[model samples]
Target: AEIGQVDGLLQDFPANNQAFRDANFDIEQLRKDIDQSE
Candidate 1:
């Protein structure tokens, strides 16, 4: 998913936000990686 898309989802779902952080999902880094891949 796009960075903004996921970020919005997290904002709308607090529990998911916590789980995302707990899982070590680095959104910024993932965005950078995706950018470079493209």
Candidate 2:
């Protein structure tokens, strides 16, 4: 069951990544926010 779940996640990863990029997700800004809180 775990193996099947992993396989599904692997198959979905590219689509998920594309959607994440399409949303203009900003990693640098996130890091900056984290830095400010620290």
Candidate 3:
């Protein structure tokens, strides 16, 4: 069903967003750590 597919996509959107945010945050933390070490 198209509606079911749409709902599934919507549900996945937040998870994807969170994953991206987490990755960005981790990268930022690593940058800070490296800067501190230098």
- Top-scoring candidate (TM-score): 3
Assess the local accuracy of residue 32 in candidate 2 as a C-alpha lDDT between 0 and 100.
Answer: 83
- For candidate 2, write residues 1-38 as lDDT tens digits: 69999999999999999989966667767878999999
Tell me the whole-model lDDT of each prediction, alpha carbons only.
0.83, 0.88, 0.98
Question: What is the Cα-based lDDT of residue 26 in candidate 3?
Answer: 100
What would the per-residue lDDT of candidate 3 be over residues 1-38, giving only the tens digit for each residue? Answer: 69999999999999999999999999999999999999
Worst 10 residues of 2 by lDDT: 22-31
Residue-wise C-alpha lDDT for candidate 1, range 1-38, written one tens digit per residue: 99999888878898877878866767777888999999
List runs of model 1 lying over 4 Å from the truth. Answer: 1-25
Of 1 and 2, the candidate ahead on TM-score is 2
Cα RMSD for predicted model 2: 5.8
Clashes of 3: 0
The TM-score of predicted model 3 comes to 0.77
Q: Which candidate comes out best when scored by lDDT?
A: 3
Candidate 2 pairs with clashing backbones: none
